[model samples]
Target: MSNALELLKTRASPKAADLVPPGPNEAQLNEILTIAARVPDHGKMVPWRFIVHPHETRAPLVEKLIANFRAGKPNANDAEAEKQRLRFTNSPLIVTVVSKTSPNPKVPDIEQLLSAGAASMNLLNAAHALGFGANWLTGWAAFDKSSKELFGLADNEQIVGFIHIGTAKGEVFQRPRPDLSQIVSKR
Candidate 1:
């Protein structure tokens, strides 16, 4: 019990966007992703997925996203437009977790979404435990139809998060956790 509790107590999540390049190489990243895949999947459906945007190839994708964004919002200024472009190209490695929406009546979409979320959190934790930083973020892109189409998501698929994983370029501060009493309920 103490060992399990100790690990929980020491677990720290760094700002994933703050992560820099030269992250875990291909082999290491693959190993970590493989570890993350071992999550609790209801009905063995594997209703979640991952897409890696490596640093080398992120520029084109980022440009594509920015262009798509501009198509929808033609009047965006330079700074505003640049922000959208940096989201993909900024990180050394961006791993997107996509939730697969299904028509299973017994297993609600909420549960499926939660499963995807768990997978994302696991990916972050797995990377951190392996001496790396990870941040999961989503803005206009996650819900943007054009962006989803660019990512090649299926009709029933939606993005759960876009996780940035790499080395820490700056200090990672730990925020205070909420009191358990505020959230827990007695049966």
Candidate 2:
């Protein structure tokens, strides 16, 4: 098989906690974002943006997230709050895909949203191609209003995903995939 096809077939998301350091450096990150931006942008409307959350910001962000989680879930125990605390800090770097849909007469909102989704996938693929493990994820924090405000997301913007990027700490098991025959249909 071709190299591109081989890479596509082998690509899989590693668990966030299982991801280690040595993430994309400055140059690598720039290239990765460049690759990520090359998506199907209809009407030349780039309805997406990326938020790079590096190591230094992780602690403060996690603290804020934990507070938000506790406030939202008053019944949550210490363990649950701790889980929230470790969410973003588990990985060395996090690239948040933010969808900023605008009023467009030519292109619909759905198409712009798809572009954002494509960007997210592209980021994951780019990280993997650069020899890093990445996982696209969104949890309760993604939907929380306080968290969104903390992230500085505008009213029209939404969190598409939080992509964790780093080296895999352990073995990455390949889960079973659906057979083409089971899902494919003849036109």
Candidate 3:
């Protein structure tokens, strides 16, 4: 198989908690973001943008996420709050993909959303190609309006996912996948 096909077939997402440090450096991050932006953008809408959550921001962001969680769930216990806090600081690099969808006459909102999804996938693939383990995740923070506002997301913007990039702690075992025959259909 070709190299690209081989990479695609072998790429796997390591668990966020299992990811270590030594994430993409400044230059490598630039390249990854560049690759991420090269996706289908019908009507040139460019309806997606990235928010880089660097190391310094991790602590503050975790605090904010914890606050948001508390506000959203008043009765949340310490365990729940700690879980939310860890979500922000688990990985060395966190890139939040924001979908800035707006009312456009030429392009439908669904198409723009799809473009954002493609961009996120591109980001994951780029990180994997760069020899980093990456995982795309969306949890309470992604759906919580208060959390979104705290992340500086605009009213029209929504979080597609938070892409975590870091070094793998150990070898990642391949998980089960659906067979082509089971899912594919000939029209």
Candidate 4:
């Protein structure tokens, strides 16, 4: 497998908040996404979609998130409250990966969902390999019904991840990984 495991071992996901400006340019971003779209899709449904929330209009989305958080947590202090909003606006580029399921006989919805999730991971890896920092996060906002509605997702659709990509503001130390034996199985 050309020692793919080595590349996997070296991958480091930066903290979402630590991602700074100067994100992927158009050509680079497109290349990374094209690579990501190569993830396995059962039944070839291509059950995932990407919405690149460009730098310009991200403020409104951040405002909406702040309102959602403030309303949801009435007692949250200003700093704590601001954190939720900052998560959105801080990233130079945010790729919203939506999992749009297909009602098909040959492919189970679960498989489609997995494919979408795989696509998100592929995007994260692609960004890192392209010399950028990326973080795949799904906070409370991801599961919020209102937020999903705002994204225009249909009933069968869901948010797999919000990939935050940008230059790393500082060094990100890689944490330890779980032992493969603990999670892997052999039959």
State each model's CA lDDT, in order.
0.84, 0.92, 0.91, 0.88
Q: Clashes in model 1: which pairs?
A: 16-134, 16-135
Query: What local lDDT score does residue 168 receive in model 4, on the 0 to 100 scale?
Result: 90
Candidate that would win on lDDT: 2
Candidate 2 residue spans exceeding 4 A from truth: none
55-90 in candidate 3: lDDT tens per residue? 666787788788889999999999988887887888
Residue 167, candidate 4: alpha-carbon lDDT: 93
Candidate 1 ranges beyond 4 A from true positions: 1-7
Task: Score residue 47 of candidate 3 by CA lDDT.
Answer: 96
User: Which pairs of residues clash in candidate 4, taking residues 3 or more apart in a chain or in different chains?
Assistant: none
Report how far residue 105 has shifted in candidate 3, in Å. Answer: 2.3
| RMSD vs true structure, all candidates | 1.8, 1.1, 1.1, 1.7
Worst 10 residues of 2 by lDDT: 55-64
Alpha carbon lDDT at 165, candidate 1: 87
lDDT of 1: 0.84
Would you estimate the TM-scores of all the predictions?
A: 0.91, 0.97, 0.97, 0.92
